[model samples]
Target: MLENWHDVNGLIGNSLIYFDRNDQQWHQSWIDTNGSSLALAGGFIGGVLTLSGTKPNTGELHEIQWRPLKLGRVEQIWRMSLDNGATWTPRFRGIYYAVDQQN
Candidate 1:
């Protein structure tokens, strides 16, 4: 999570995303412990796209070039697997803190 070096701790993160230039297509996701804070990426993230082919008449190869952002919140998680992804366990868990007196 984009962190704050100050606060009694902190509540949630206020995250946003923007690319180098104002062109092309993209997609993103946002999340929070209470489903409040949001994160984003382009639609092309983890998606396939047609690429210029190395051979003639082959057109283009589809490419998938989307990277998911790992915004760490108190509620974010990471899965640990000993069997190389055969199975996984939650390695990380976020601590839930209310942002208000009544949440």
Candidate 2:
């Protein structure tokens, strides 16, 4: 579930992958408590992703990175850092699978 700084419920839709002309970085757009924004950026290599943004209400900073896999299924090893990428804490590992059928 998604929530705002005030703890109000929010929503997120399908991810949009695009290249930001301003920053010259690849990013995925999503809607969160902070409205629609770039939630993830294509990192250095090996499917590494990074996220750094400020909270809407409290102005708190957030930083996270992960390496994702998506050949047959979706999986990621996500990590979070509070001190400007100085250190990271393994929070959770997630995976999802889906199939398509035609009648």
Candidate 3:
């Protein structure tokens, strides 16, 4: 999957999600206009797609989850743990809806 968007401050961001059959896991790479980037790897857990990893430069642990909702919508949550996963703080949360193609 591919995604591109800009925040209210006009910070362009892009991400790619793919499945690596060799490891049987899903991976995602994200980068933003601020030159920040992140890489995470994991698979579905309890029906939710959760991926997590640490930032190579900052060592900050990050996790992102995508949950399915009704009417083909989805909820995405991004979290961060500065204390080695001992405590988590929500960084971003957004709901996504499928675009109507027949428009």
Q: Name the best candidate (by TM-score).
A: 3
Model 3, stretches more than 4 Å misplaced? none
Off by over 4 Å in 1: 4-75, 95-98, 101-103
lDDT of each: 0.34, 0.54, 0.94
The TM-score ranking, best first, is 3, 2, 1
Candidate 3 residues 35-87, lDDT tens each? 99999999999989999999878989999999999999999999999999999
**Backbone clash count, each prediction separately:** 14, 0, 0
Per-residue lDDT value at 86 in model 2: 72
- By lDDT, rank the candidates, best first: 3, 2, 1
Q: Candidate 3: TM-score?
A: 0.90
- Candidate 1 residue-wise lDDT, 1-103, digit = tens: 3342222445443433344356563422333444443233334423332111111233222221322333532333334444434555553344444466775
Off by over 4 Å in 2: 1-15, 20-24, 33-38, 47-71
Model 3 scores worst on lDDT over the 10 consecutive residues at 1-10
Measured over all alpha carbons after superposition, the RMSD of each candidate to the real structure, in angstroms, is 14.6, 5.9, 1.3
**Residue 37 Cα positional deviation in candidate 3, in Å, after optimal superposition:** 1.5
Summing lDDT over every window of 10 consecutive residues in candidate 1, give the lowest-scoring window.
Answer: 48-57
Q: Residue 79, candidate 1: how far off, in angstroms?
A: 1.4
Steric clash pairs (candidate 3)? none
**Pairs clashing in candidate 2?**
none
